[model samples]
Every structure is written in C-alpha cells, then in structure tokens.
Target: MNKKKYQIFISSTYKDLITARNKAMETILGLYQFPIGMEMFSADDSEQWEVIKQTINLSDYYIILIGHRYGSLTQEGISYTEKEYDYAKECKIPILTFIQDRNVPTTTDEREQDPSMSIKLNNFIDKVSATKMCDFWKKPEELPGKIAIALVKAFTANPQIGWTRVKGEKLQAVSSELAETISENRKLREKIEELEKLLVTQKPVLSVSLNSNDPIELTVPTLPSPSKYPQLLRRDHIPAHLTPYITDYDITSYNNSLPSKEEFEEYNKNTRYYHLKKASIDFDISIKNDGKLKAKDIFVTIELPDFVEVQDKFDSYKNVLPKNPIPKSLLEKAKEKYIKDNNIKPKTSFGVTGGLVALGSIIKPYSLEFSSTYDDIIPHLTKSQSINSWSSVKDKTITINVKNLIHTRQKTFDDFVLLPLKAGSGFINISIICEEYDEAENYTFPINVSK
Candidate 1:
C-alpha cells in the first residue's frame, strides 16, 4: 500500500498571525503533509475568496489561528479568516483551533487599534472556543509544537483519503481502465434512455373488474338441525354392508350428539356450534392484460370490512351428519305394525333393536325425519385452481398470486367466498400489483349485507 500525505489548510489573519501561520505551515511540511494557505491571494479581494474556498475543498484538514486583531473585513463585513473557517466547516473538514492567550501582552502594532475591530475579534474568538476544543498559545513559537501534536492525534483518530504518487506504468494502466469505464458508462446511459422511452410507449395496461358491479346482497341461512335426522342415533348399529353408503350426514349427526365424549373429541378438533348459523357468498374477480408486454408476477389483494370474513374452505353439513341405513318410510311402517301388534299406549317409551328410542308422544311421529341415500344433499362449491394453489386468507383479506398474465389474456379468480358475520354496508377494496406496472391498480365495489 502507498503511504498518503494529507493536505492541510491554514486560515488566519495576515498581519497579526503571520509568524504563527508560518510556524503551522512548517510543522505540516515537517510531518510530510501538504500545506494550503491564503499567502498567494490577497484576502480582501472578492475573487480571492472563491479561490480560498476551492483550496479549502481540496484540503483534508483545517487549522485556524486567532490573535488580537480580527484582520481586514470582506464586503460581507466579516474577517477573511472567519469566512474561510465557515467555508471549511460547510465542507465538513476536520478543524484544529489555536486561540491566543488574553493574558499574554501584545505590542500596539500586533493588537487591534480600532475598538470596533477588537470587539469583533473577541466575539470571533468566543465563537470558535464555544464550538471546538481550542489550544492556547502565548507566542508564535508555541504553534509549531502544538500543531505537530494536534495533527498527529487527528491523523490517528480520523484518517483521510489523501494524495499518493503512483509509478509511471501503473499510472498509464489506471488511465486506460478509467477511460474504458467512462466510455462503457456513457453507452449504458444511452441504452437506459432508450429503454425508458420504449417503456412509456409500450406500457402494459391492466384492468381489474368483478363479474357484477352491483352491490352484493348478503343473506344468512338457518343452520341445519341434527335432531331432524333419526339415523344419527344408529351410527354404530348400522349394518356393515351399508358402510359404503354411510353419508357425511351420518358422521356429522353422530359427532354432534357426542355419544362417546372421548371418541367425538378426538374425531373433531374444530369448534362445534349446535345453533349458530354460517353464511358465505361466492363471487368472481377478473383481470385483463391489454398491453403489448406480459404482466409478470401479479398479486391481487381483496380487503373486506371487519364484519365480512374470507375462508379458505367453508365447512358444509353433508355426509358429516348422522347416518342411518334404514329408510324413514320403512321405520314409520315398522312402528305402526309394532304399535298394532303390542297395543302400546300413547306417550309410551320403547327401545327398538337398533338403538332407536321412541320418546315424547307417539301421536306425533318424528316431525323432522327425512331419508335419502344420496350423499350430496348440499352441493360442494367448485374451488378455483389458482386460488387453491396460490392464495391465502387472513381475517377479511384474501391475497392471490396469479403468476404471469400474458398480453391480451384475462384471468378470473372464481374461488373467493365472502362470509358475512353481521349486517353491514361497505365497499370491497381490491388492489392489483404487477411487475409491469409502476403502481398498484385500485378498485372498489359496494356490498350491503342484511339479516
């Protein structure tokens, strides 16, 4: 690695601190560092201030020496030394301050003759002392030693990227590499401009819409009663030959009664509701890509109000209920024959062979009993493939990833089911985001739910 030499800027009033400034410059040079000062330009000239700022910009560190005189003022009514210090601070250069000790006696020529200038000098000294930790110097000779110590500490604490001399061969190689890099950068910038123009003209246009824009009406259906089905009581008593015919209704009804508490608990892990009704509404949302380019990595998010709910799958009461292999008509006919044969009285309790218990008045046959061999009393809603494969439901929000949608193609998400928990009116918000679009496309549709 090449050793680096830092450039240090020395800022001070010329007449009062000329000797001190010289000592600072010598100290920096002795340390093998470059020194920049206002020696070349007249401090009072406006044009020289620009040159001073430029030098300060190139410097890694700033050293300011304050004495009895504030020095000559610029057009801005501030001393050139103070102006330079401000510019250094603006550039965020590391600064070292040396203030003259007030106790040290100074000759008439070395001190400020004007009262106004003396006040400004004292204020300037106070400003520097308040802002930075400053060293006190009694004489010009004290600056060299103090400056050397300060510079060493600064170098160790805050190292700077400074000047280094490279070999001739290495310099030529670096020059060639830099030239190639600049040329490549220019070509890349041109390509980027061309791409941006093409993007503006051939942008993908995406439109999202629902199958129906009319406000969705929500309705809640009564929960199916398990007591209506008598076959549930004979789940274990059903013949082995009828096991395949056992519908989800038989299982659900048996589970609801929970005849064996332990077995039912193990079989059903979800919460069970005997009376609470569940309501769900299904809808379709479609997205059409009309632009020339394909819309890649598309995500659609639908957010409903708190009263509405989105579920991955809605539980249906079908083969899940109690099942009995015997038909209800046969059971009724057998009961009438048994009554006529035994001459049983009304409101009599009797146990049938298949764990069938006749309760309440016999005058009223089980009012809700119905018999069907078909398993699909309640049809299953067809699930959308895209939703089943790449969708998630959380509370009232449903997020679906439709992957890449090709140009001039439309995709319909038909699996979304909205369950309303209560009656409410709100807008269903839909947001679509894709790689081809600069921003998300938002849409809304009204929904009114009634009990």
Candidate 2:
C-alpha cells in the first residue's frame, strides 16, 4: 500500500440523525482500525454546513450519510448535501452513498397536504441516487462491514478518493455556514450563562481576519500559514479528488499565484501535463443546469483550425446546432480535417462512420443520455478498455476491472475510459475519462460494420 492516505468527507443533513450517522461513521473507522486519514463530524459539529463542504473538498469520497429527511430544510436554503454532491461532481470526485433503512420520503394521500415538500424531497433523493454511486443500504449492525468493504474497494481503487474528500474549508463553506451559525447560537447562550468567568483563550471562530469557510482560497494574501503549519499538503489534505487519475502533484504556485476563488477555479484553455512522459490534457467544459457535469452531452466543441481537421472549421458548425442536434455535415468536415492533417489515414472503407451514427441518435429517447464522453486518448478501433469499476489506486497505479461499470444517466464521470496499463509501462497515462460504449460480450475497435 502507498504511504499516502485518504481524506473522506462524511456529508449528510447531519442535524436530523446525527447519532445514527456518526455511529455508522465510527463503525466504519473502527472496522478500518482507524487509519490516520479518516475523519468525521461529531454530533455537536454536524449542523455546520460550511464545515461539511470543507470536509467534502478535503475528501476523495463524498460519503453521503443518507437517512430519512436528509438534513436540508433545517439548515435553510442551499442544501450542503446537494452542494457537496454537485461540487464533487464538478470536481470529478467519486461518491459513495450509505443509505440507512429509514423510509425514504414518498407521497401518500394524507401526505399530499405538503406534496410540494414531498416532491422536493424525492427530487433531492433522486438527484443523489442518480450519480449511480456505490451504496450501503443495510441495518445498523450490517453497516460497519459494508462500509468497510466499500471503503476498501474504493481505497484499493484510489487512496486519494478517501484522502482528498475531507481536507479543507472550501469544501465546507456553504454547508458548514449553517452549522457554524447554529454553533454560535449555542455558544452565545453558553457565553451568557458564564458571563462571570474570566476568558483565557483567543477565539479562532469569531475572528474577522480570515475569509469564509472554503479552505482552498484562490487569494494568495489569505493563505498565510502559521509556523507549525504543515508546509506541504498531500492529496488527502487537499479536499476532493480534483485530478482523479494522477497520484500526486504540487499546488504551492497556484496557491501563491491566483487572485481569488473564481480565478483559480479552472483554466480557460486546454492544459497539458506529463507523468513520466505519458501525455495528459485537461480542459473544462462548463457545467450546465441540466443535471450533468461529465464530459458527454456537452453542447459545444471548439476546434483550432490548425489543430483540428476533417470537414470544416468548428466555428462553422455552431450555427447548425442545437436545433439540428447532430451535425453530420460538420463531422464529415472534421473527418476530412483528420485525414488531411494526419496524412496517414486509414484506407476508404465500405462502412459509414460510427461517430456520425452515435451523434445522430442523441434525440432518440434514451439515446442521448450518456453520449460524447471524454477520453484521454483519441479512441481507436483496434483496442479499448472500459472501466466498470476501480479499486484503491496507490502511487498512480489503479486496479481496474471491466465488470464494475454501472449505467449513469448523467454525462459526468462516464466520459473517461479506464485503461489498466501493464507493469513497466513507464508513466501512467492519467487522461480524461469517457464512458461511451455499452457492455458487450466482445467488442472490436474501429467498429465499422456494413450491411
């Protein structure tokens, strides 16, 4: 196992069932014999929404502690549970939901009085479930072992998943604010009760010097560390697995350089990085409100005329969209550009292109659901790999299998392919993921089939 550990954020509507949720978390930690990386909120601490996001950002896995009435309304608007899940999705963090057997909210004739709340509640539950996350829906006694197994599987897949989920304040900002506010209210009462006592210590929580809860500040001026502060933060401490494929990287310069949260969020142009000479490129397609944060089903594609070739300039295709959803003419232009630019194109085949057919089916009911996923490498016909699932990844090596794949209705996470490179492959090709294909008994690449 790699010496590096995982940080996971245990997120839920913590107010409603803190005891059961904390016990489940404790059981999970105890089962693992208490690794140094794992952390969870106490009953007194769960009400703070900002703290939850910070925990989520610090963690690799957003362990949603799902029970009845997941602690949203009590905290006020901006459910941290949803925020963490959405942000984690935005950040590409894996989610593992642990559902307790409390009856999930459903509508009945008597309950129809507040059908709106019921509808909202069910929608929230559905959104959380839609991620197709690994779940633990068992009795309290059965939860410990199940949680342990899931963590082990997820950790064996990637220690970073656990490590990054619970690291910083940015993860907890929105979620913990409500909790912190509640904490202050309780503190104010305590302070009133003990007004006669001589105060001995400086209060860090009430100090106005620091910014809001998000620990990962884009502002350099605010990131000053105390003398005893750990100078370097490992992936476990960085909150949320920002880069899912790679094992470790440095953020000192980015921390020192960026101006604010918005600036440091993501770069506009495509950026490239190398892990021991294996090439990886990264570019963010802005998140949409249509409940998708993945690479597939993105509306726009920009091609630098020189960088991309085939039919025509990508700019020309913009006018054709969203009405004529599949731009076959544009793809034809792109194919021409690919052939012209690469020069070593495949010989003319009798069959039509799969890319065209794939795009054409987007509007056919479920056809467009998870199309156009991201891939690190340009997909080729000869060979490919599908990631049904992955177990803890250590030092850049992820144990991947083809059987763990689950259908996701969203475009996020399904965009990248999981390639299990062999030992001695030199560097890990940690690329953008894509979930583009259906499960098949046998699949041959360049899948050009003709009638």
Lowest-sum lDDT 10-residue window in model 2: 202-211
lDDT of 2 by residue, 1-451 (tens): 4344565556666545556566666855664433211224433345654665555566666566665553334344545466566777887777777665535453342122455665665777777766665564644566666767777777677556233234467767856987899999999989876763422221111111011212211111121122121233344543232233223333443234334433322221111111111211111111122222222321222121111112111111111112212113322344455445555334254334533222333335432322343231234312223343222323423222333222222212222212112112121122122233222112111111111
1-451 per-residue lDDT for model 1 (tens digits): 2278899999887876778988998989999999988766876677877778888999999999988888888888988888888888888899999998998999998898899998999889888897654799999998889999898888888888889887899999989999999999999999999998998877778777765554577864454433332334455654453445555575564446543544444333222231222356666777788888887888888888876666554342321333323244433444555555666644456544343345343444322332242244436556556532366677778787877778899877666666666678888899988887788989887887776
Off by over 4 Å in 1: 1-207, 212-214, 222-280, 312-338, 342-389, 436-443
Return the TM-score for candidate 2, rounded to 2 decimals.
0.30
lDDT values for all models: 0.72, 0.40
Query: In model 1, how large is the Cα lDDT of residue 360?
Result: 44
TM-score of each: 0.44, 0.30
Against the hidden true structure, what lDDT does model 1 obtain? 0.72
Backbone atom clashes (below 3 Å) for every candidate: 16, 70
